[model samples]
Structure formats: C-alpha cells, structure tokens
Target: MGTYRFDPIGEAPEQIRFRVRIGPGYGSIRIGVDGIPQEWGWIAEEVADYRGEKVTRWRRSQALQDLEAELKTVAQAYNADHGSNVMTDCFMQAFFVFVESEDPGRLAWRAEFERRRRDRRA
Candidate 1:
C-alpha cells in the first residue's frame, strides 16, 4: 500500500492542498480536493534521434520547482513520521525519476488496479 503524507502550510487554513503518489510504476496515488483530483501528468520526451537524447515540450521548470517545494514543506512532518520521502522526491522532482508517496486512502484505486493486474497475470 502507498503511504500518504501532508501538513498544513503558512497557517493559511489550507485553501488548497496537493498530493504525492507512491506506488509501483508511479501510478497508484489518486486523490482529490473539493472532489476534484489535482492535475497529474507524466513528462514525456520526443526523441528526435539518439538514444536518451529526447526533449520534452512541456518542461515548466520554475513552476514545477515552486510546487515541489511547497509540497515538500507540507509533507515534512509526514515524512518524518513515516520514515519515507513519499512526497518530495528527495533526489529531485524533475525527470520524474523519483515519485513521492500519497496517503493510503489516496491510493485505493491503485491498490485495486494492482491486485487486478497481478491476479490476471498470475
């Protein structure tokens, strides 16, 4: 099961909140605020040629860094409690190599999907 962790920031009453998903293949975490799932997308690269030399058109570096930093602050307490970097992608947020974990309930759908996949492949 993927773990979910978060903390309030700025004492601002949490007008908005974000999520981090931790699961196999990075496709397990899914939750929503105000009944809407936060925008989630995977960065893809267009290989013009050459192996590992692809460029992504949707690279929004500064914005992503800002969001990542915010999420990290909120999830610090959670990370300490759980002993996991399930939210901030300790190595780096760009490249999408490391994925943060979400709350357990956040991954309910992912858990179900994994179970189904395993049962089918078994």
Candidate 2:
C-alpha cells in the first residue's frame, strides 16, 4: 500500500494529521456494474501520542466518508474513465490513520491510482 500525508483544511495547526493509504493487495475483489471487478474493504484508526504513550482510538463513519470523497477526487484526476472503480478498489484496500502531528509532504497514493488505471486498460 501507499501512504499519504496532508494537513486537514480549516483545522488547528499541529493538532491533528490525516493519513490515507491504499492496499498492497489487501481484501477481496468484487464485480460491479457491467461486471467490472474491484476490491472492497476499509480500515481506520485514531492514534494519539499522549505523555510519551501511544493510545489507539476508534473512528466514526464520517471520517471514512471524508477520506473516501477526497480519494475519489484524486482517482478522477488519475483516470477519468474508471476513476470511481479505481477509487473503490483503493478504498476497499485502504488503511487510514488519523494521527496527531505537524509534518507534511508524505502523499504517495498516485502510484496506486496509476497502477489501477493500467489494470483497467489491460
């Protein structure tokens, strides 16, 4: 899977960081409209570094929806033809992390979009 990092919009600085990731071939494949095959599944975690200790938390569906919507836009930019399908595959095999940090420049999901695009062409 590929890992990505970006600061959430209209949020407090250094308060929280968002991380999106696509699979390294995780989950099962399913057929969609017109018998188009795509993967399906998702994992999300909330990790907090508190007092030099790491704690894990569960995320609500809203977080996943936000991430999915953002990634769909990315997929559309990658390949207009099968953007939604490719994005679905990506999301199905994704692992998201909502971290508490301030570092940036870790976006890496484009490679996956390109790979899925190539697969669609094949």
Candidate 3:
C-alpha cells in the first residue's frame, strides 16, 4: 500500500485535510479525515498503444467487486464530522492516479499536476 496526503488545490492551507491510502494497483482507496477512516473500491482501465493507435479497456480486479457505491460519501462524512464543507470542495479537486508503482512517467505526470494545482491556488 502507498499512503499520501491530498492537499486542496484552491483552498486555504487550513482547509486542506484528507489522506488517501491506495492498495497495490489501486484496488481500493482508504480515505481518512481527522483520523476517521472509510474504504472505497477502485477501478482501473488498461490503456495500450497498438499499431499507432491508442486503446483503452476497462478491467476489474478479482479480489473485489466493481464499485457500485460513490466514494464521495467519505468526504461527506468528513464534512459532517467537522461541521464544515471544505472537504467536499477538496474532494472535487482531487486527482486519483492509477499508474504502476515507481513508474517514471506517472511520477512526472503527478509532479506536473501538482504544479498546476499550486498555480490554481495561487
């Protein structure tokens, strides 16, 4: 599992408060807010380049069922607990990366996304 802290892109620093822990290949996203935990299933699509064409196919993991529930419910719960809606907006701006671990391309993509996110906040 990989753990990361998600910072709100266009909100005040104090309003940023969410943690995302993803399983290998993003089997799930464990969202936490103010130390409360909620689990959500994650889905991934396989993209391939074949004959100079880009193709994407949705794939399902055998360990879990397809995600039929909304993941934002976790954010809603967090907002209710804090008596504030900041988390809702934060969740709206979240970027969920589904690349293989330690992949250079994915790292670069995430870095650039973060750069843009910071600029938006600025």
Candidate 4:
C-alpha cells in the first residue's frame, strides 16, 4: 500500500504553488504513465495548466499535446497487455468526493487511527 498527500508552498506572486507526494519509497518507482512531477499533482503543469489557453502558450502548443498523447500510449500498453487480469482503478474528484462520499470514509478512518494512537500512548 501507498499514501499520498498534497501541500502548498510559500506565498507566491503570480502563481500558486502546490506539491503532491507519494510515500513508500517516495514514489521512486514511478507507477504512473504521465509526467506528474513528484512536487506537483496528477496533471502535468506543462499541459494541464494551460489547457484553458486553447493552444496559445507553450503549454497549449502542439508539443504539449504530443507529449500527453505519447504518455497515454505508453500507459495504454499496460491495459492492452494485461486486459483481463488488470484494473487501473481511478475516480474523478467529484465522483469520489460527492458521489461515493470518500470524505466520510476518510474521516472515520483517521478517527480510528487517532484513537489507536492515543490508546498506545496511554
């Protein structure tokens, strides 16, 4: 099993800063297909950040799409080769947060951990 957390960094002027980290070897294995920087989230800033630009800036340029497409192709190899035995479980934020109520589950789980930690200390 692995764990991930997101954190924001120093107050910025023109840009917001955030970091995404995966534990258990510090995401050294790099299980994902896309170029999600260890210091950033799932979406690569190179592409996702400028998606609103409509191919204007460097991020919206053809190069970015080419990179994203290549990454998708590489990732597809996993499913293509191991179609029956494999499953890449994924969920959208709204789906997991609102539809499935992951927040409640996470809270209940954290509460249990806190209780156990307190018990151990006692």
Best by lDDT: 1
Tell me model 3's lDDT, rounded to 2 decimals: 0.39
Candidate 4: give the clashing pairs: none
Candidates' RMSD to native: 13.5, 18.2, 15.8, 17.2
The model with the greatest TM-score is: 1
* Residues 60-115, model 3: lDDT tens digits: 23211212122344333443232336756643323243222222344457889999
Residue range 1-122, candidate 2, lDDT tens digits:
87876622332223334443343453322211111111111233446666756554433244434434554544445432323356456443232222231111112355567889999999
As for candidate 1, its clashing pairs are 3-102, 4-102, 4-103, 86-100, 86-101
Q: Which runs of model 2 end up more than 4 angstroms from their true locations?
A: 1-64, 82-122
Better of 2 and 4 by lDDT: 2
Q: Which of candidates 1 and 4 is the stronger one according to TM-score?
A: 1
Clash statistics: count for each candidate: 5, 1, 0, 0
TM-scores, each model vs. reference = 0.28, 0.22, 0.23, 0.22
lDDT of 1 by residue, 10-69 (tens): 322344454545657653333222221223322333555456665433332343344445
Q: Which ten residues in a row have the lowest lDDT in candidate 3?
A: 33-42
TM-score of 4: 0.22
Q: What is the lDDT of residue 9 in candidate 4?
A: 21
